[model samples]
Structure formats: C-alpha cells, structure tokens
Target: MSDSNTTDFTNPSTFILLGIPGLEAVHVWISIPFSVIYAIAVLGNLTILFIVKLEPSLHEPMYYFLCMLAITDLVLSTSTLPKILSIFWFNSREIDFNACLTQVYFIQCFAAIESGILAAMALDRYVAICHPLRHSTILTKPLVAKIGLAVLLRNGIVVMPYPFLLMRWSYCRTNIIPEPYCVHIAVVKLACSDTRVNSYYGLFVLFFVLGLDVIFIAISYMQILRAIFILPTKDARLKTFLTCGSHLCAIVIFYIPSVIYSLIYRFGQNFPQHVHVLLGNMHFLLPPMLNPIIYGMKTKQIRGRLLGLVTR
Candidate 1:
C-alpha cells in the first residue's frame, strides 16, 4: 500500500489498472456485454464515416461536421474501450503512467474538438435557417477551416497542462484507478502527492471551458427559436425547425449527460461507481453513434445523395 512496497516502475515499465474493483470477480460476464457495445459503437461510427466519405454530395459544411463528429467519436471510444475490453477478456488491465496519460490526453482532445464542432454546427443551423439569405456568404469553406483550427488550438492548450501536472505528481503509492479507464481526474486523484493544482485546473475546465460552450449553444438555440416564430409561412417554419431538430436532439443527449456527470462526481457523494462507469461509456459512445444518424436522417440532400450513390 506504501510507495516503496509496490514494484519499481523502472523494472516493470508498466502499472496495473485495477479496473472496476468489486466487479473484477465477474470479468467474464462483464466482457460479454461490454464487447457487444464496443463492437456496435465502432462499427456504427465507421459506417457513418464511410457513408460521408463515399457520398460526393455531402461535401458541404453540414456533412463535413458530421464526418468530423464520426472521427471524434472513433477517437473518443478507442481511447478507453480497448483497454476496458482487455480488462474484461484477458484480465490484463496494466497501463503505464505514460500510456495512461497519453490516453487521457487524446480523449480530452477529441472531446474538446467535439464540443467545438457542436458549436460550429449550431452556428451553421442558425445561419441556414435564420439568416437564409446570407448563409452561404457567412459559413464559407475558409471560415469553417479557420473555426476548426481555432478549436483544435484552444483545446490543445487547455489539455496540455493536465499531463504535465500528472507527470509532476509521484504516484508510487496506489495505482488502482477506480473506474475502468484512465480518466483525467480519477488518475490524478490517486496520486500520493497533493492534487490541489489538478483539482483547480479541473474546476477551471468544468466551469470555464465546457460550461461556457454549453451556455453559448443554449443562447444560439434561443435565437434560433425566436427567428423560427417570426417566419410567416407555416411550412417554411416547420421545415426550418425539422432541419435543426436532429442536431438539437444530439446536443441535448451529449451535453446533458456530460454536465450531469461532472456535477455528480464533483459534488454528489454516496453514488455508486458502477453508475459512473456506465455513464462514462455512454458519454463516449452515444454522441458518435447518434451524430451520423441525426445528420443523415434530418438532412434531405445528404440522405438522398447517399442513397443514390449506394444504389449506383
């Protein structure tokens, strides 16, 4: 249990991730369900990405966002599921500190990218529906590229500190992460040294980065609603609302669970770890799996074109 008692890091060159402690007894049983979900998640996202790439007509802004979403989902799910499945099937959950941090880094990056993409998509909807006359001029290809680059840079800077802070902390003592994967906060929490800085940074991210993005999304939707009501033609209003409906649903499904999990983990106590694990998997999987469906089902042009391409 002490720092010196555990095997030396230099010799072993790996640390065991004591995954889902109480449930380790049922690793085999867990594998059955976990494998199924993992397979479906990866396959589902890949299909979306394939359809987006093959369909030439989906080269526009909206489908581009959907493609990006699929890519992000694949990264996000890959970050954790392989390790999780290892624990389930092979009973091997060892992950070196460096590897663990690397996983966390990528997960944070993709999640941040997805958030930025959501905001961009929301803005796209606002323009397409509310500012119909000027939508084309506003969301030009160059502008979209600029927005994507900005999002990547912003998230990179924010998540860059996490791994550095983690490296500074000596975790020779207890290496068992409570959850299945190497979550940023969860990994930091296990450190023997003081984690005040990590906690502070985590708070900053929760409130400032994720919090601000959600707020902006909400405001954008509000403006969208106001614009919708003012449209004189009933058919036009319905069509406009339908266009944004799928995205709106995806946003709620994605953001609400994230916000709720952050709040529950930070403030709420006496909650079960299993609940956290389940929610974490959902958070990683749901957005990617649903995003393609949302965009494909809602967008008439993309759907029709994709179907045509498939048939031809």
Candidate 2:
C-alpha cells in the first residue's frame, strides 16, 4: 500500500463491492447453491476435456470444437466463482482498482471467446451436415486448431484495450460498487469523470465481438436447417437435427440470459438493485453448470463415454 501522504483519497485506489446487495441475510445460504454449481461446472468441463483426450475416436473436428467450448466454460467459471464465493462466504469485498479491471478483462475476454467458439462450432456443423463430402477437406485438424487459436487471439486482443480505457477516466465518486463483481458499466457508474466515451466504446465492442458472432452463428444454423429439410430420408434429417440439438441448446443457454441481462442493465433503470445483481451472477454461472449437461444428454458419444466413466 502507498503511504497516505503519497496517495490521493479522492481518487481512491481501492473499491468495495456489495455482493448481491439486499440479500446479506442469506448470503451463506446462496453460497451453498453457488458452490455446488461451481463445483459441477469445474468438474463437468474437466471431465469433458479428459474424455475427449482419452477417447482417440473422439478426435474429430466436431469433438475438437466441443473441446474448445469446454475449455472456454472452464475459464469463464474460474474467472467468476472465486471472487464471488469470497464475497458470499467471507465478506471480502475490497478489491484493488487494477485487480477489478483485470477481472473484468478476463470475464469479458472469455465470454467473447466463448461466443467465437460457438460460431466456429456452428460453422463446423454446417460444413459437416450440408457438405458432408467436403467437411473432411474443409475442417482438417490443423484448420480446427487454427480456428480455436483465432477465437482466443481475437477476443484477447480486442478486450486488452478496455482496462486502459477505464484507466483514463478518473474515478472521483463513491468507491463502492453495488454488484458482486466488476462489470463494465457498473464500475463505470462509480467514476465521477465523464463516462460517455467509455460507454460508447463498450457498446462498440459488444456489437463487434458478441453481436457479430450471433449473426454468423444464426446464419450457420439457417443453412443447417435448410440443408436438413432437403434431405431425402427421414432418418437422415433426424440424425442431422439431433447432432445440432446439443449446440443449439448450448447457444440458447448462453445467449438468452446474456441478452436478457444486457437489456435489463441498459434499460431496466427502475428495477431493484438485487434484481440486477442476481441476474448478473446468474448470467455468468448458468451456462457453465448446464453446458456439459446439455452435451451429455444430447450428444451420443459424450453420453456413452460419460456413462462408461461413471460405471468404471
């Protein structure tokens, strides 16, 4: 810590987070469910990773894309859970301004990359189902690896500027944040400086990173649907739909709550603080807990291996 003489208290170096404000009485109770979800998310994603690696037959392009999704889920869950649990269990809410920005960076980066991975997965499905013969040629192992790397790098490079942008704005107002975590606009609201520039940049990034991915993913699914309907045999169409079912469920699980939260955050000014806080936490936690479950229930190969692993 800097000496008191060396620091300006007006523009504070530390900020306090009010974790799920208005629910302090049941924080410990909330922690139970949160802990269970976090454990499942971590264990489930790790299981998918290990099963993919152990089963050589699962080393196809599709499974590789699933692996990327699982890795992103793991990263996403880790970024949110530790700090949140600390808030819930121990009431440790003081975070360095720099650390808060760092957490937001990873939170946003992993989220954008997850969206990118979903788009890539959609593309892989489109190629496989629509152009089966060319699927092998188009989605080679090296190509899949390249796609994964591109998603990671794209989000990492894009989100790198955010913390720097926030640094430019002087935070002269209250140092208390109302949410459990350092969300962008939430943190920005605490800044006494003009925040229009930061807000605009956030919107731009949101549209470019997540919005663009949504468009591509939607397009991929449309093409897949068109191709599926054109198939001559009922069995063939059913098979195609089944294969896509898991990814579609995953997309819905991730994006629906995300979009809802974004809408509420931007426009639901009349909503209660707890409403915003609860939604924010759920938006991060739900997909991680459900993604592997969706895959296990819908994807046959994953189900088979999961069963074998459980029994063994």
Q: Each candidate: RMSD to true structure?
A: 2.9, 2.9
Tens digits of per-residue lDDT for model 1 on 1-312? 222335434223455676666677887887777777667667766777777677776677777777677777888878888898888888777787789889889988788888888888898888887788998788888888887788778888888888888888776556667777888888777677889988889889767667887888888889999999898999978987888887888788788788788777777678777777777777876776666666667778767866876799
Provide TM-scores for the models.
Answer: 0.89, 0.95
Error of 2 at 203 (Å): 1.4
Highest TM-score: which candidate?
2
lDDT by candidate, in order shown: 0.77, 0.87
Cα error, candidate 1, residue 195 (Å):
1.5
Best by lDDT: 2
